[model samples]
Target: MENQKLILVIGGTGAQGSSVVKALSESGRYSVRILIRDSSSIHATELAALPNVTLFQGSQDNQKDLHAAFTGVYGAYVNLNGFSIG
Candidate 1:
């Protein structure tokens, strides 16, 4: 991860978010940190297996989680899940 930009992705286990996260990680241009509800989830686990991809378990609606996600991130993809937050 040295000299790589770290991007924090919300909803990274979802359809669009997962696609974007995979693309970014595979590009070798950036490292990605995914904020998800469960690290044990199949989707999350798959994403975490990719190089430059990591999992940070937390809720999107929680300020503490948001703060944690925002830390050390060069950018963010905030695709909030309607099912989880609505």
Candidate 2:
């Protein structure tokens, strides 16, 4: 695992995020950690079952959760939903 880069992915069960997670997980170059609102969800469960992948239960609005999820990760992929610049 030390040889692979660690990436933290937000909204990883969603359409766009899932694609990113799938590509990265299959590449063998990254150990992926995904932040999901519900770890028990079917999508989350499937992702958790994949090799070199981990699921952390939390929301993007929670700073504490994000801090924990970001720990030791080399990079992050964030997908925001219903976000507006205003």
Candidate 3:
């Protein structure tokens, strides 16, 4: 990733965002950054192993977490769970 643009992915552990994250990683274009509640989870660890993928452990509701996740991102893909929010 010489001039890679970092894409921040929210809800990346869920059904939808996981695939997006993988595709982005496989594309070899942008660097993928995912925010997850459990950084040590199997899925999180798996994503971290992918090319250009970085895992950041944090919740969306926290401003500090959001700030850190959003830092220097080229763009974002957010798909928060409505049920979980309720």
Measured by lDDT, the strongest candidate is 3
lDDT of 3: 0.94
Candidate 1 local lDDT, 1-86, one digit each (tens): 89999999998988899999999998999999999899998999899999999999898889998898899899999887677577
Deviation (Å) of 33 in candidate 3: 0.5
The CA lDDT at 41 in model 2 is: 95
The parts of candidate 1 lying over 4 Å away from their true place are none
Clashing pairs for model 2 are none
State in Å the error of residue 27, model 3.
0.5
Better of 1 and 3 by lDDT: 3
For each candidate in turn, the TM-score is 0.95, 0.91, 0.95
lDDT of 3 by residue, 1-86 (tens): 86988999999988999999999999888999999999999999988999999999899999999999999999999999999987
How well does model 2 score by local distance difference test?
0.91
lDDT digits (tens) for residues 20-76 of candidate 2: 999999999999999988899999999998888999888888899999999999999
Worst 10 residues of 1 by lDDT: 77-86
Model 2 ranges with Cα > 4 A deviation? 83-86
Q: What global local distance difference test value does model 1 have?
A: 0.91
User: What C-alpha RMSD separates each model from the true structure?
Assistant: 0.9, 2.3, 0.8
Q: How does candidate 1 fare on TM-score?
A: 0.95
